[model samples]
Target: MKRAKLVIGLLGIMLFLAACGNLNSSSMSSSGTNGSKGTQLTGQSTDSNYEGVIENGKYVTSKSRGVSNTQDAGNQLNLKSFEKGLLNVSQQEFSTNKYAFREGQILTKKVVSNWLARESKSNADGLNPKDNGSTSATKRNPIYLQQLEEQDYMIQKNNKLSLGGITIGLGINSVDYYKKTQYGATYETKISKAEAEKQGKAIANKVLMRLRQYDSLKNVPIVIALYRQASDDSLVGGNFFAYSVNKNGTTKVKSWEKLNQKSYVFPIADSQTSPNTNDTTSFDNFKNEVEDFFPNLSGVTAQAQYTNNQLDGMNVNITTQFYSQTEIISFTQFLQTAAQKYLPAKVPIDIQVSSTEGVQSFLSRSENGKKFTTHVFNSY
Candidate 1:
């Protein structure tokens, strides 16, 4: 009888262990934590959802962290503009006052690479169209898709952080550049605005469907924006053309809202006319005054942003040959006065004064502000 009881106890223990193993496997599969580094969260209040969850006194980072995930390493300007522009676009749907920000934890590097590749027999997961044996730019199919970026939002409930929303930025190529043969001249394939919009929307729909397959993302609200990337030789980055929002548990994007946004470099090129004449004149006046004040300046230029054909903001970069601290300070003060007097008072303006050595001073004014705030960097 004693031997039989011992046997029964051993069998019961074996059954319990096996059951626990199954439970762990199920949890891993559902949470999508298999081989993931996992997130770190500190159970502390951030005072506001916009501030996001705090981890070790800092905002929580994504499971797949760092800048290695971003594509397009050739143009640093486009990369910076693309990332910042996406954040601003996201603010329209996921307001900072309500939602907390988090770097994307979903869509790993491997997943993104697959989605960016051309579809073929072996790679059914690829999103790009398969290559046909065509050398002509007019007949050849362009790589419409360029880069993918993801941002996640979180909401705190019952002292635990949960995924509240997500935003994805699809960088579509306006011009596809490639070489047909080894050591051959490069060719350019231009994609029209209408065609880009159509392809972007289609790709967005497919992305939504794939995302819904994951249990964690099935019911999460997602905002997807279509960004038209600037050409390789473009001086500035392109703007987002449209966006769509998919509500919880929905896999399809019903409709898209158009965005009327544009960016222009100061002193409009001879080939391209200014969109806003008054704004252009104001900037030109401001430029002339600053240049007159500092004759030893290397160059002065500005990048302006427009929304609905109205000036939204301007960033001025002043390159100087002066090195004296006093000279830098005086120029910065003069820039402030000139900017206020000549530049539009309705929009924010940022001025950076620099030399070959590095940044010398900075000046800025808030929208409709009466005064400018000045800061001069100190060298050790």
Candidate 2:
């Protein structure tokens, strides 16, 4: 077996070297932003184009784009949740069938940083409230807006892609965490839900007005979603509570719609039972079945998404002590069977099986689908 592994590694290296010969033949295109042009290697996907700097001839990344000057208050979980949730919301207004998705290019880091700063003598264009001298949480105005994200939607017309719409996500802090001095203890200023929504809408209006100043964005419809960020200590990120859209030629947001979306960790405490008891019961049965079969399993956990008080989707993670390829494959097959029998059939389900070596297998089923697609990674 050791000799076979050595042969396989050598063959892999040979194949990699052979593929390098085609590097010069790979086509490259020009991607322009504002007035500056950047090189974009022809990507494999024809569905949409990326907006960030190209990397490694095959990937696009934002690292070279620079970071926002605003102070970050949320963790990685919050950032991921905030961005993913915003994209989901945008899809409803800008359907994938009609519009091509693109990362935001209109709001540069410098522009976003300026908008997040407080209004002052030199920074008169700042969107945040002017800071008072007081250090008291209640007396001093808090930084309600933490981050801003923009997504652009493009439509192809006569072989050219043109901007069709824009979606903006506002991440508002629920609790402002700050300290008075370098060595002082941190304090929390909690903002009520109602207050956050109110301030978010006001900020959205201001953002819309500011965006309208640009000639290219004057006639494009814009969708704005307000997200209430979770506290600094929270394990799960916050949710988007409300959203509004401004139609073309409009500079003000007139109406808003409330979103009743929530996410819960599996096996929730009895005191904090979810309103959808059926999903909770189903997930509990599935967890029990898998654990009963694999006694040496580390744990099985799930993050369930609920929309309008109904189960929408779920992502389950299973950690195990097994590492052998055959064992991983067997466990994955059994888990798929158990999931189909116990989990909700109408909701999309994604399951990942992992060990100390990282992910070993994946299983997923789309909404209302009866079959699950399974894949077990090759252990080299």
| Full-model lDDT, candidate 2 | 0.73
Best by lDDT: 1
Task: Give candidate 1's TM-score.
Answer: 0.83
Tens-digit per-residue lDDT, 11-43, candidate 2:
112111111111112232322222323333332
Q: Candidate 1, residues 283-329: lDDT per residue as tens digits?
A: 88988888888778878888888889988888889998985998988
The Cα local distance difference test for each model comes to 0.74, 0.73
Listed per model in order, the count of residue pairs whose N, CA or C atoms clash below 3 Å is 0, 0
How do all models score by TM-score? 0.83, 0.80
Regions of model 1 farther than 4 Å from truth: 1-72, 182-184
Span of 10 residues, lowest total lDDT, candidate 1 = 1-10
